[model samples]
Target: MHQRNISTRLKRRRAGDPMREFDALPPELRRWLAEASLPWSPRSARRIWRQGLKTGGVDEALRRLESAEVATLKRDRLAQL
Candidate 1:
């Protein structure tokens, strides 16, 4: 058997049906997700969306998603240094 490469993070640990979860998201959120910089789990994205909805609405949710993606990118770049 071939040796496996070391892992940097966890992968594919889904507890529920990811497709179903994704299908339940708002259409606008789904569109935004298509252009997102990172692989965002449906549950986490929904949590942020709900938070933004509470604070404002759909536009606010999109802003929150963008803000989150930018922050994650910055952290990833710093880790690579």
Candidate 2:
């Protein structure tokens, strides 16, 4: 497979059906994704979404996603150092 970027450590083979996973996302999350910096895989997003839902609720899940993005950015930044 083609490499997107070399420095970042986060990468995974996308599992399951992407279209169905994306379509199942709440509209708010889809909109949030529109503004996201990371190209979040559908499976990852859904996993986090469901995890957040289980732990708290939609708002909590959104917060978790934002946190995940920030953490990824930090990791990429460190990789560049």
Model 1: per-residue Cα lDDT at residue 60:
96
Candidate 1: which stretches are off by over 4 Å?
1-13
Q: Estimate TM-scores for all models.
A: 0.80, 0.75
**Model-by-model lDDT, in order?**
0.76, 0.77
Error of 2 at 41 (Å): 0.6
lDDT tens string, model 2, 5-79?
234566657778878878888887887676777778777877887888899998999999889988988888887
Give the range where candidate 2 is weakest over 10 consecutive residues by summed lDDT.
1-10
lDDT per residue as tens, model 1, 1-81: 322222223243566887899999999988877667566778888999999999999989889988987786667667767
Q: Native-vs-model 1 lDDT?
A: 0.76
